[model samples]
Target chain A: MRLSTKFSDTIHLLAFLQVYSDIKLTSAVIAASIQTSPVVVRRLVGALKNAGFIDNDPKNHNPRIAIDPKDITLLDIYLITEGHTPLFVIDKETNPLCRVGGNIQPVLTNIYGEAEQAALTVLNSKTMQDIIDSLIVHNKVKQAKEKSDLAQDA
Target chain B: MRLSTKFSDTIHLLAFLQVYSDIKLTSAVIAASIQTSPVVVRRLVGALKNAGFIDNDPKNHNPRIAIDPKDITLLDIYLITEGHTPLFVIDKETNPLCRVGGNIQPVLTNIYGEAEQAALTVLNSKTMQDIIDSLIVHNKVKQAKEKSDLAQDA
Candidate 1:
């Protein structure tokens, strides 16, 4: 159940890029914002660049969004990073003598693939803009709740 | 994308149970077949038992399937184990000054929930019998290929 923080960090980076499209952002700045190491940010930035999600100019060392926020989906980022890795790893030393153990790998692999595809389908349906809009709505709701609480106290 | 092997191991254990329903299975035996520690198997067995997926008689210390294999889906096992855990975690220390960093957690949580639900839907569509049937098919194909190779060698 424990997954690497790569996907979460990737989305954080992409959302940051979208929100601050006007600002020139560096890995160090991103690392600072994400509270992660610059090396980690640089590594993920490399992946994003390779996936055609971001543009990291060699001359400036500044990274920018390459795809439109409306065009990019969370699933797109998930595939580029975590999606490249298998969801679960089959045990390498399962007892071959057991009928289930001998053939479980292929069965599990097929099932995992189908499950991952289903997840990807859902993620593909949602764009970065959709995430941002939801965030905006959440922020408004929070502000309204706080305002209501403050008024009740008065 | 690296997830814990609990789900895979759970399926392995369940499929073994279905295939060998006559045998009184112990954690040690299950662990041996799964290539995992007995402690790990015991822990998962506890979860499965608590979730009403399996029965562990205290007097015998042996486990048995409580539900019909045809009635149990991978999604049921997923829900009892890995599905209880969050698919992704948000960075708690993200820089609050950054707009996206400040608001990304809720947005990401929402998206992860939807994606997980979609995956669960797919998994729910497949039962343990389906996996066992596929495994049987695979074994036959493998045996047939081996027989053909042996014929050519002879």
Candidate 2:
């Protein structure tokens, strides 16, 4: 199965909200930026909006991230999107009479928990500002490269 | 939609092989422990065996883990199972005219790489022996609890 892009889409929505806060936000506009349908964008915005991460109604009204960009971590978005689900799944149909089968689930559960926590810690370490800052840096680099190509063409 | 348990099942298969080494290994026997079909067990065994992590032909021959348990990390299993696929997905169809959409994919890609590496680090920290050890510990705890409960009932 393809990995769901819901988490990344939501992050993009938030970053879009922050980067273009001057424009009156609509699902269509954000969807255009995401290159997905407005329906998908509205749904994502609705999730973040209901979770209080973003402010504004989802009926194509003005939308913006409600929280400080610095305060919103990837974990903050992830918790609402994907982090609540277990990363690793254990086989539940194992024979309880067998020692290995009987005890494997809990052992796996503990290790999966630790691994997910480590991943979440990394997600929590970065703020929305970090994402936006990185975005700006990449944008600038691309622009500079474009300018050099244009100068060479001239 | 659902996360695959292929990795966990492989781990269980290997642990069972190592623990029950005296017993002849068969896919049906492994399936019985995993509470799944022999076909499923064979598929898992085939993967591990082909990867050089386990020994023996997967046609119900004497199958056993080939590597040292302590040397085989969870990452080793995950790499063949889920780790090779990205844990996160980016919206690649984003509009390049917009700064957020234009540069979001690469920025998110970098961040996702970091988060996955952190999770992988935790998975790599634990060897197959660690999983088996935890299983044994959990088994002892359960056995003790069961005995205490039987005495109370008696």
Candidate 3:
């Protein structure tokens, strides 16, 4: 099954907001940071705003994270961005004449629902702060390695 | 986050195989039953066959379920179809200059991995038999409702 990068992109957006909470972020600035277009950033920003994840004023056009990063989980971001859609979509035009085709949608829907709930349970265990903390550690490690490489070169 | 229908289609294909195990099923027949093209059916069938979920004879081109339906979990099917890929894909070209963009991939990857494992836990609790039983029940209910409606019309 092909998975989209929207989920990752959303997280990146949120982490950026959290890390740079002091700065007023614009769509163009976010677009440049995420290596995406301003239109894409605006669309996601709109969704996040609508979902109460972020607050944006039309007059100001600057977006800020509304909820506490520690209070938000990846599951929350997923639900906000993707809505309540199942992880896998069933074909709407499956052949009804065939027994499996006729009955599989509901059965699979139930199964997918359970799987999603399970995934949410895991995601809920982690807060956005957890993600930010890891990112900080990762950046520090990379910086340390870069410094070591420069010292060797000298 | 658009989802692919491959997972549901795969389950439909497998359920059909179990229900009609006595019959020699061809890709065309399966495609017709699943309301998909022969090429699509062949692709999924090939994947399943390679993953040891089904067996196919090259000369005859007849496919049969290689594993007991009761032994095949949705998690197994998910793993086979998706391999070790996370449910969410991380963008490799995210802006490296941005602190969050540079480090978010690994953090999100770790979170996604945990979420997938949790989802697998739920999927593992269910077997092909569970799906088949649900399908059988669904079919019977639909048939009964149809019969009742017909009797009322008469």
The number of the candidate with the highest TM-score is: 2
Candidate 2 scores a C-alpha RMSD against the true structure in Å of 2.5
Per-residue CA lDDT of model 3 for A12-131, tens digit only, reads: 888887787666688888888889998999898888988889986454546777888899988888778665556657777788888888888888888888888888889888888898
Q: What value of lDDT does candidate 3 attain over all alpha carbons? A: 0.82
Q: Among these predicted structures, which one has the highest lDDT?
A: 2
CAPRI-wise, candidate 3 is: medium
Task: Please give the range of 10 consecutive residues that has the lowest summed lDDT in model 2 chain B.
Answer: B56-65
Q: Tell me the spans in candidate 3 whose CA falls farther than 4 Å from its real position.
A: A1-3, A56-62, B56-62
lDDT of each: 0.80, 0.86, 0.82
- Model 2: per-residue lDDT, tens digit, A20-92? 8777787788888888999998888778878998887465457877888999999999889886567667778
Q: How should the candidates be ordered by DockQ, best one leading?
A: 2, 3, 1
- C-alpha lDDT (0 to 100) for residue A154 of candidate 1: 100
> What TM-score against the true fold does each predicted structure earn?
0.85, 0.93, 0.86
Ranking by lDDT: 2, 3, 1
Candidates ranked by TM-score, best first?
A: 2, 3, 1
Q: Which sections of candidate 2 miss by over 4 Å? A: A57-61, B57-61
What interface RMSD does every candidate have?
2.2, 1.5, 2.1
Enumerate the candidates' DockQ scores in order.
0.61, 0.73, 0.66
